[model samples]
Target: METVRPVETWLTDMDGVLVHEEDAIPGASDFIEALKASGKKFLVLTNNSIFTPRDLRARLLGSGIDVPEESIWTSALATADFLADQRPGGTAYVVGEAGMTTALHEIGYVMTERDPDYVVLGETRTYSFEAITKAIRLIEAGSRFIATNPDPSGPSPQGTLPATGSVAALISTATGRQPYYIGKPNPLMMRSALNRLEAHSETTVMIGDRMDTDIISGLEAGIRTVLVTTGSTRPDMIDTFPYRPTRVVDSVADLVELARAGSGEM
Candidate 1:
């Protein structure tokens, strides 16, 4: 096997890479410990904007993972950071949970429903038709559309549920406007994460389960990418994509050795 270069920084997806539903995938805890012991900067990235990092940390702990709150990044934070950079102290009409709202507030953004500067959409368990209607009208009235992520659906115990991208599409169809998605697949999110880590893309590695979102974004951001087949993707599906991840593994367990190697424990 060819020697893999040690990465100084790591960006990993949360859903499939770390946990599946409420259960921690095998080796997840060890991988996190390895990264921490290596003294490398790492962030757990997620497209779900329904919960805050604190909430996510609690959830991960319940599943046997011990990641710190500061080490988790979400689409909500990325969206807020993007907005703050584009228009500081701007007002927005937000349709999301406390995670999205809190992030915007911390960045000095005001939340309003009447004639706001922008209509920010994100993940919500109970998406209100009335609110989506309001978003359409707001966009028609000249508010720019911005969505936290472009994921059409999200995984659940029962099944899949409509997510931010589906809601964004409804509003777009109603108002003839497309939302600027700020999560994975958009290199802006990766750049924002890199900035947060104070890390260079050349020496960073992105580990994710989905190729379309995680792998493609890392490639575009000039970082090494690893695709784990323990989540939404299957090994049989790898050949379908035109682009490929730098490495493919059966699960996160397979990376534990590499992670230890990166930490010079081999």
Candidate 2:
């Protein structure tokens, strides 16, 4: 077990940790404000690559959380950041939506529909057989493969539906080349969040609802992780999962209480 030290930063999940289906979670806003007031650095780390950072920031503000557009970090942003870092001027064959294209474009990437240097996959509602075929061809022609996240499904009013990871898997199957995933569970996004915080992994804690992404990223980075039950952290899977968080709290309120107790602030 990694010894708990003075926390300098926090990487938080947005969907289940901060809000649930557009409805902000109780204590989320206040807790965030508290973190800010305490001068603790944090970022809203989300896997929803469907929306760009500006859109997501607006959504969060609309939900009543004091989220800055600049403080928001999505899988799209992570992918864009990664691409920019790896190959700034590389041409990309994007199979996602406005978020993917716009982010890449802003990072000075050249976007094309054919014979690109990279094949980047994200949540695309307009999945066509033609697009998949094109991606396969590009991969075979030696295009670098990249994926936003590994989540198979996303929560919706109708129920779970295919996410970006599903499409990325399809491309991987076709090309026999594994993709570099940029979202939670992958340290890529966490590294981006740490950069945003001007902090390193060792002094930061990753708090999220899902163990697969949040806890896994923390483990990979050798940091503390906190699982919140109010989000996607399932009950039955805790003990069974290979990675375990340092603590689990029921809600943001509970998290504050727990933190206070640990720091003798209560």
lDDT of 1 at 21: 94
Q: Where does candidate 2 clash, by residue pair? A: 185-213
Cα RMSDs, all models: 2.1, 2.5
Writing each residue's lDDT as its tens digit, candidate 2 over 38-73 gives 666778888877788788877888899887777788
At residue 256, candidate 2 shows an lDDT of 60
lDDT (Cα, 0-100) at 130 in candidate 1? 87
List, residue by residue over 91-178, the lDDT tens digit for candidate 1.
9998899999999999999999878989999999988888888888889999999999999998899998888988888888888899
* Candidate 2 regions with alpha-carbon error over 4 angstroms: 1-4, 257-266
Q: Give residue 51's error in model 2 in angstroms.
A: 1.0
Worst 10 residues of 1 by lDDT: 257-266
